[model samples]
Target chain A: MRFDVTILGSSSATPIYNRNPTAQALNINERFYLIDCGEGTQQQMLRYDIKSSRIDYIFISHLHGDHYLGLVGLLSSLNLNGRKKPITLFGPAHLKDIIQMHFEYSETTIQFDLEFRATDPSKSEIILDNQDITVETILLDHRIACTGFLFRQKRRLRKIIKERVEELQVPVEYYAVLKRGVDYFATNGQVYPNNELTTAAEEPRAYAYCSDTLYNESYFEQIAGVNLLYHEATFAHDMLDRANETHHTTALQAGEIAKITGAKKLLIGHFSARYKTLTDLLDEARSVFPETELAIEGKTFVIES
Target chain B: MRFDVTILGSSSATPIYNRNPTAQALNINERFYLIDCGEGTQQQMLRYDIKSSRIDYIFISHLHGDHYLGLVGLLSSLNLNGRKKPITLFGPAHLKDIIQMHFEYSETTIQFDLEFRATDPSKSEIILDNQDITVETILLDHRIACTGFLFRQKRRLRKIIKERVEELQVPVEYYAVLKRGVDYFATNGQVYPNNELTTAAEEPRAYAYCSDTLYNESYFEQIAGVNLLYHEATFAHDMLDRANETHHTTALQAGEIAKITGAKKLLIGHFSARYKTLTDLLDEARSVFPETELAIEGKTFVIES
Candidate 1:
């Protein structure tokens, strides 16, 4: 299974220092999920060679311009490109109103079905579920109503030993049952043990995205033990006071959250436009969590299971 | 008088081949007026070194995403940067609803007063009047309610011949009145003629911005004899049928309009994304009107007298 995330943009509210606003692309087994599309996100996707047509789900963390302003433009282009397949959008209820008002003024009816599922910011609950993965919303503390997302891949089925199954003359229909940890019984009452023909699969892995939020522990348990955790570090340790005032998190606070949550790795981004150089911010994060990495735009990070 | 236009974006509906969507920045006597702010406009303004803070007014020809989607983002940034001076926006009446809806969702109170002046699409009217110029709306023929803008520089105040005014020992209190082209009478019964004290200022120049509209004869007389004309040429002559179907103008038709209107210079843009190179479109326009020039991004065109 391919589980990786590409940072399309990492700048906070303002686009400066050649860094765009907050946007990311998550690929789970070839299913593309766009998260928090900011301004210029379509151009960034084009620059990074990410096919916008493949994105089936879009997750918006908040209603801030930097988080969801590119949505309408992207949707317009998708319609222009003759996209017929329906796409699901997860965000606050008001986001649908904003998108609809523009289309109404333009007098354009979208050719594809645009389904909006509102996310609740007051509680953590399952928002999406499929055969491959399940997504849950993590209530966040921000100036505006915001929520994070947690993606957890389902555990893989047991691997079948082809030679053992063939040698035992197991029927093709029994293969699926064997993989489910059941013994195969022959017509003559000869049994093929499941343990001898199968091996355990890799454990389920999870990824979490938390952005534009203050340091709060209410939803920390929901994202505990994630393989990868992406958190916004809008400022460094020196600007902790400013971060608190603005309902943002510092690099040190992000690192501490990752460590306390037992995340395997930490990805920090949503950098403020004030810092032209990010070395000190990265170093500050690494001081607390050595597994920290900067979520640089156009770079992809894989989740290992 | 610093009457020049900077092409911030020029590509039609979709931004492709490194070409951006439609956006323009017009500078009239150091007062910047942004016209048709598309996506990535602020970034384009930053790339071209155009100061956003200097933009006092914004004009939108229509509600298509390519023409006005960037307005809210730009307004938000202005508020974030602590802009206090009021800025007026001239567009359709519903444009105000679209802008206000987004701000409401984000729960942001714009620090600056945002004034919306609705433009009437049924007839021509002066939408904006100031000391330097008067802006008139040109009722356009398009699929939607759209209007072009005609900027006429108010006739400049008569220049005071510096040496003549000093030689006559004209009192400072009479300078403003003298520039109004009136004869000055001295207490010693001396008469100072206005012609001897001032030379005729250059004739007032006009610039017309016609975009996202079909070639129509109704507004031709309104923009007759303009110094510079910017018209949308969305397609080449070969694609005239497509242009007509989409209610857009082809390069050949744009040139014909400019020639019939007697514009001194023609600037053609709003190119279709299908053409990676714009030479053929430029050549097509130049074939009919030799004064045609491509409205290249980041390039400034002077509306000279």
Candidate 2:
């Protein structure tokens, strides 16, 4: 399974010349989950050649224009392109109303099934549970009701040793049971240990996305030990006061959170437009967490567990 | 006087890869007037090396997100860049409310003066008149309340013959009167005719922008005989029915409007995302009006009167 995170946009509330606003894609196994669609997200997806049909769900952090202004346009484009599959969207209660009003005023009737789930940003909860993955939301501190998402891939079943299964004369019908760590029994009631016939399953990978939030240690407990963590670094250390005033996290603060959470790697982005060059931000973050990397647009970072 | 029209963005409603939404700059003498600030219009201005300080006025066609989503962001950037001059904005009535709400929520206090004037999309009237130019609104047909703009440079003053003025021994202060088409007289009651020392001024130029409008001939009277006319062509002739159904226009329809308006030249843009090549659109428009040309991004077309 290829588990990775792609940075679709890395800017903060404002739009800049080259940097885009907040958006990313988490690919778990073969499915893709979009996070925080900014103003030009659909065009970014097209520029990066990401197949929009592969997106199964979208997780929005808040109702800020920079965070999710592109949703209606993306949905309209999907309808224009003849998309029929159902897409699940998780966000605040008012998002559906906003999108509905835009479409209603424009008289644009979408052709896809959009299943919306209102997420309470005050508590941690499991928002989605599928066969291959599970998605949980952790509350974050922001001006508005905001939540970060943690996507954890489900553990795969152990594979049975083909030679051992053949020697044991296991029927093809019993393969499912064998893969589930169960031993195949003979008609004479002879016992075979399950651990001896099957190899252990691979370790599940996990990714956490913390968007547009202030430095809050409470979220560390929920996203601790994640293979990859993406946190918004809207300012550098010099603007710590501004970050606190605006309810945003500085690069150093994001790195400190990564350090406290013991995350495998830290990806810092959502840069403010004030800083044209991110060298100072990267240096400041790396001083706190050695494994921290700046989130560049259109680049994919693998999550290894 | 430097008079030309520079295309900042040529794309339509939905932004495509590398192609931005509708935005253009009309340079009349030293003043630059912007038209239709779509998403990333400020970045487009920066990319095309347009001086932000030189831009004195902005005319937005409608409230559609693609037409004016970038205005707030552009204003924020202008404040960040330390612009102190006042900027006048002309758009629909609701736009002021939208911009105010965004700025209030973001807590961004601008440093420069932002003068906003609401345009009535149902009428054709002169909205702005300055020392060197006059801006008028042309009612357009769209899904929303939309209007285009006509920028006409003020007629230039006649040139004075410096040698003739010196020979007549006119006072230095009287040179201003001479430039204003007034004859200068000596204290001895000597008569000097205005035509003897002055040459006729060049004819002023006019450029009309008809953005996101359907094939409506009612606007021909308002935009008739413009030196340059830019009309939206969202589709080719094959999709003429779709264009009409969506309240848009085809390339042939844009050319037809240009021909009806008796424009010196026509520039067609606002291409649909389905078109990867614009050769066919150019050919189709030229078949109707031979002076038609496709609007290419970052390309400047002179408005020859």
Candidate 3:
């Protein structure tokens, strides 16, 4: 199974110069999920050759312009392209109304089923579940209603030893049962041990995304031991006062969060436009969490299980 | 007086390749007016070096995502930049409610006044007037409420012949009145004719912008003999049926509009993504109207008086 995160836009608050606002694409297996569509996100996708049609789910953290301003445009483009597959959107309660109002004014009847699921920003809850993975919402500390997302892949069945199965002449129909660790009993009264026939399944991987929030430990337990974690580092530690006032996390604080959560790797982004170069912010985060990387636009980070 | 239009984005419905959706910046005597801000408009403005702070008025043609999806992001950027000057926006009635709702949900209290003037798409009316110019709405035929804008520079005061005024020894205090084509009366009772003191002001220039509209001749009378005209040419004559079905204009129809309106120059934009090369569309328009030009992104068209 392939799981990866692609950076679309990383600038915070305002898009300036080459850096765009916050937006990312998470590829789970073959399914694409969009996170926080800021302005110019569609353009970013186009620039990076990410197929918009592959996206089946969109997760928005809040109602801030820099967070979800590009959502309407992306939806409109999808409709114009004649998309018919249903798309599930998870966000604040007001997002549905806002998207609907624009469509109503434009007299555009979307050609796809748009399902909206409102998330409670004040509590942690499982928002989505399927055979492949489960998604939970983590309440974030921001000025307005906001929530982060934690994606956990489901445990897979054990891999069968193809040569051993063939030598034992096991029936094809029993492969599913065999993978589930059931010992096979032959019609001749011979027993085949499950451990000898199969190897253990790979451990499920987990990824977490946190943005536009202050440094708070309330949600740390939910995201602890995540294989990959993406957190907003809008400012350096030197601007800690401003970050606190704005309810935004500094790079140092983001590093501390990663360290506390025991994340395997930390991706830091949402850089302020004021910082032309992000070397200082990256260094600050690496000082606390050694496994830190900057979320450069168009770069993809793959998670290994 | 400087009167020019800068093409920000030129694609019709969906942004593709190097072309974005519809967005333009119209500069009239240094005052900037943004018209039809599509997605990625702020980036386009930066690419063209059009100062967002200089834009005091915004005119939206309709409620289509390609026309107004970028407005909120632009407004938010301005607020984040600490803009204090009030911005007047002219659009459909629902636009105000939509903008207000987003702000409310984000808990953002804008630092500047955002005045909204609702324009009735069914009527032709003067929407804005000041010492510099007058803007009138031209009802356009489209799927939803759509209107074009006709900008006419206000009648200018005659430019005084400085050398002649100095030779006549006209009093400094009387120069203001002399520029108004009034005959100068000396304190000694000597009269100087207005023609000798000043030359007639350059003919007031006019520029009309019609976008995302069908081929309708109803508004031609209001825009006759305009110095410059920008009309949507979403398709060529071959796709005329598609253009009609979508309530958009073909290149041939746009050219006919330019010819009938007696516009000095015609700028055809809002190109469909179907056409990888617009040479054929340009030729089609030029065959009907010789003074036709393509509205290439990042290009500026000056309206000569």
- Over A36-116, each residue of candidate 1 has an lDDT whose tens digit, in order, gives 999888888888999999999999999999999889989998898899998999999899899989999999899999999
The candidate that achieves the highest TM-score relative to the unseen native structure: 3
CAPRI tier for the interface of model 3: high
Interface RMSD of each: 1.0, 3.2, 0.8
Which digits, one per residue and each the tens of the lDDT, describe model 2 over residues B1-305? 77898998888777788788888988887788989887767667877888766888999998666787677767776777788999999998877876776566445688999999999977899999998888999998888888989988899888888888778877888767777788767799877888787776878888899988888888899888999999999999899888988789999888888888898999999998889889999999999899998889889999987
Q: Docking quality tier of candidate 1?
A: medium
- The clash number for model 2 is 0
- Which one is best on lDDT? 3
TM-score of chain B of 3: 0.97
lDDT of 2 at B156: 83
Q: Which stretches of candidate 3 lie over 4 Å from their true place?
A: A184-193, B184-192
List, residue by residue over A1-305, the lDDT tens digit for candidate 3: 88999999999988888899899999998999999999989989989999999999999999999999999999999999999999999999999999988888888899999999999977889999988899999889999989999999999998999999999899999999999999989889999899889998889999999998999989999999999999999999999999999999999999999999999999999999899999999999999998999999999999765
Ranking by DockQ: 3, 1, 2
- Please give each candidate's TM-score: 0.95, 0.91, 0.97
Ranking by TM-score: 3, 1, 2
